[model samples]
Target: MSDIATVVDLLTDALGADAVDVDPASLASASHDTWPVSTKWARQDEHPYPADVVARARTEQDVVAVLRVADETGIPVTPRALGSSVTGQPLPTRGGIVLDVSGLVGPHSIDEIDMTVTAPAGTNGGELEDALNAAGWTMRFSPQSLYRSSVGGWLATLATGQFSSRYGGVEDLVVGYRVVLADGEIAELTASPRAAMGPDLRRLFLGSEGTLGVITQVTYKILPLPADQRLQAFRVPDVPAGLAIMREQAAAGLRPFLLRFYDTDEARHAMADPGFDGPVLFVGTEGEPAVAAAEMGVLTEIAARHGATTLGPEPAAAWMGRRFDFSTVEKRLDTPGGFAETIEVAHTWRHIHGLYTDVKAALAPLADEVLVHFSHVYPQGTSMYLILLGQVADDAAATARLEEIWATAMRVCLDHGAELSHHHGGGLARSPYSRRSLGSAHRVLRRLKHALDPDALLNPGKLGL
Candidate 1:
């Protein structure tokens, strides 16, 4: 019998025939993620990422058993859920096993008193949010992929939602989680609002990208639904002026649930209102009516100081209504010889403009369109999202051009002293620059990876680990 068949037999014996899948279709589907390079390659009939088998784990015990067997057999296991990763984090680069936890759906419990929600890894983001909303509470974590992404996937990628400026990123929302280690041992990390613990172990796994273990369950902090919400839009002269307004508002302690600064091109595309031109800033404030009103007043003053033209709430409202729609990207990718991708990086106010200008200039020649926006604002800095779309003669040219864009963008970011990835965890696409991005800190990650996964069986070839 073949080695893979032998492994399948062992897995079937350990779990059950129903849980182990070796079908060609399943393997092919598990091969890649939403990464544009991977998608382009896939269109060319090149499946560089294919797992030998799949383990549809439905419980924590199933995860443990699969990990134990994979360890014993020295097989790489890539934990996946929802398959919404844009960085190929779930793609099994080495032929081994794809551990799918999408079926591990369990009852989610919300604690009104504690202001927290505990959910299984497979819990859908939208469902969880709806449940919280029905209970007069809000998850406050609204990623663009909320309807499609799983909780575990969010934690795995250390994602930041659209309203991160107010609620913070996934790391801030996640109070704790239960993870299964490489040796099939289950470990739970939990803490109160403030823990004087020696080291925050929860952080180690936050952005590990599943290179260390499998996150099985998560506990996230929630808040009462905002009593009032106010949306406002403004047109600024350019990115720098818009950024200054954002910085001033943030520094003055105005906490808006949503603060988005879109460049001219992105503004035109996002607003879809020809009357609104130039850089557009969409700001939303939500809370007690008094507090929301006060924040908006200060925000408007700041925008005016920066020479912004008030565009009313229509543009902001429009963006909010269609924020989750990814049809444009899907349509672009489906076009013949066309490809598109978004690279998000972060930097302090001091170097953000330089990073933006350099990266845009670097990528302009390689892409048909280069658009940018600033969101997830903070007092210290903000995250920039660079969108690139291009067409090539063939798959080979497309792949090459895509790689060039990534390489140039990363190089410019590094040169400008910006974070390589703001929210998306370093998967295969970003793995090459992981070490450079982390500098000496990369050694610390390596040590942790070695300590946790001695054999590197958990999601191999990711995060530069």
Candidate 2:
């Protein structure tokens, strides 16, 4: 009577026992995503929908084989990478199958002439960079999640990182890819230097969240490793001065790779151990040593103008060391009553001050402790990554706080006419607002998924599928 039984039979026929998971834990693991912080506080224990079977896909052939059966059987299939998505994007709510591609990371190439690199989807940013370093090259995309965030996961979820101000988002680094559609058909988007060829079909897969197809290979534009690198520290009096300093640097055309402005609260907590004076700024620049040194000087002058003081680079560097960790959140939640929440929002220079004010105000009364920080920025606007944690005595209370805070923050973003999300993909959590920002574009995405994956079997329950 269960659709899962039928879907399992179909998967067994296509992928064989080696690729399919029949174990209870494996299936359950595929059911939910890293959304417990949000779901738990809301009293949601039923989420993390476990799949009937999880296909540990190793190659494109395995992916195609599994998708073929899923399509024919009308089974819901969820594509999973590193399982690093914070939202419920990878959950198989319908519980059919999960295509785990973490093992599919393969070779990468460096075209010295074109300055591009082609790597398999399962490749991780850190691993890819290490490989490039061995070959005397570099993969420039560095998110805070580089340790666990796979290149495929990066593309699948449209992730971003600390270096985004210079390298831009994952979409900016991604140029071409090889995708396996829901129909089991594989299409390899070429790594052409440029393309006027049609609608550039590649863009569809850039941030589709696995609804359109399963990404198997990722080809990106690589750059030579910058020769010089340095991170300077500064303590600003307030948020306004920090923002003004960043804007001035951008205007002066001195773009620093590690340009971050943290809210006083987060800075205080981050540097709370000992010997920390106050709010500090970590300004890192990379390039020729002389040029980098000059840029640091420029940043120092700007910070001085903004009434900022130096906090020494040692503590700032230590903070950067532990910058990447989403798994620790669940551990904290498992204890009595702890919560972790983050919101990424971007707006034009004209709107950031007011936008930040409204967002903080919205969450003021609801949060136990709200700390804001600036991780990624652009010339046009900056991303405000807000982290709110509370002690609610149980998971349900924490979940309610997270959901309520998210609702309030989303409303703030909309009120200012800002983009719905800044990287981290639209994931399931942000899907409701997709229509508001994406408009008909969301419809087009669903149509594309339907056309490519007519059975609606791929990545079910993600991006509103």
Candidate 3:
């Protein structure tokens, strides 16, 4: 039998006939993800890189079986969960086998005493959070795709939540995880609160985007539901003014769960208040009630010093209610000639404003509407999100325009000495510029890839591997 046929039979035998699917619909769906270009391709009835077979794994052993077959046959295997990656992180580029792990979700456990929750990698992020909340706890990692994304997908992409300012990113919350290597070797990495080991190995696969191995299970640090949460909005004079307030708040070592600042255009668009002028800043704090109140007081004083006008809690409360809503992007992408995408980059406070201004200006000609926001703030730097919505002549034109939009944004970001991606890990969309973004450090990734996945059989063509 040919390689494709042989692999199909092997996977079917290993994972059972019912678990292996080669239908046209399955192949087409496995070929792409929520990437805007893929949406355009779907609109044009194109299955550009459909995998020959898709193997749905219901257990960790199923994942190992798929990897073992790929290792023996030298067929590329792309591990996927939920397929919610907007950057094509889970696309089956080499067309060998798409390892579906969305069904592996099961046997969840929460350790309230240790403040940790462990679950299968395929667990839905929102479902996990809801379960934790029921137990009087929370993960606090609320990405925009919370309801649509998977736990493994979040760790694979190094995702950050809207409340990243206080809880940190996925990297911070990961306590331990079990992964199956490209060679079918299962390895579990864990550590205490801190370790002085040779290297923090868990981080190796956290942002590897499934290019190195398949994450089968994960343990994340959880927090008790906050005692109090205070959210308030402020209107600032401009982007710079709002940024200054955010900077001061961070520099003061005040940890507020929310510190989102939207530029004038984005503030108006997001709030749906065209009449409202200038930029808007949403500040939220939680923890002990007394501590939360004190932090809010400090934040308010800093904003007032920066010439900000308090807009009460309504706007902030409204945002929290629908923070996970992605209807706007969905509506645009589903439209015949419409395309929408988001690019998030980060830099220190010094160059952040310039990066924002330059990237928006660079993307202006290609996109109809470019909205900007600074959401994930830190003491030294912050993340800038560039939301692009535009319409082209047709689906074909839309695909090309979206590509151009990404290229332009990455170019300007690189020019400003900023990281190409803040939390949305580099997938096919950002693979081409991985070298430029990583500079000489690119070689380190190549070396690691060779060491772990010498055959290059796992999620090839991503992270410039």
Q: What's each prediction's TM-score? A: 0.98, 0.92, 0.99
State which candidate has the highest lDDT: 3
| Ten-residue region with minimum lDDT total, candidate 1 | 1-10
Worst 10 residues of 3 by lDDT: 1-10
Worst 10 residues of 2 by lDDT: 38-47
Better of 1 and 3 by TM-score: 3
The predicted structure with the larger TM-score, 2 or 3, is 3
Alpha-carbon local distance difference test for all models: 0.89, 0.76, 0.90
Clashing pairs in 1: none
- Which regions in candidate 1 have their CA more than 4 angstroms from the true location? 274-276
Looking at model 2, residue 141 earns an lDDT score of 70
Highest TM-score: give the candidate number.
3
For model 2, residues 51-134, the per-residue Cα lDDT tens digits are 678888888898888888777777777888887777777777677778898878767778988888887788777888888888
Candidate 3 lDDT over residue span 109-211, tens digit each: 9987899999999999999999999889999999989999899888888889999899999999999999999988999999987777989887888889998
Rank candidates, TM-score, best first. 3, 1, 2
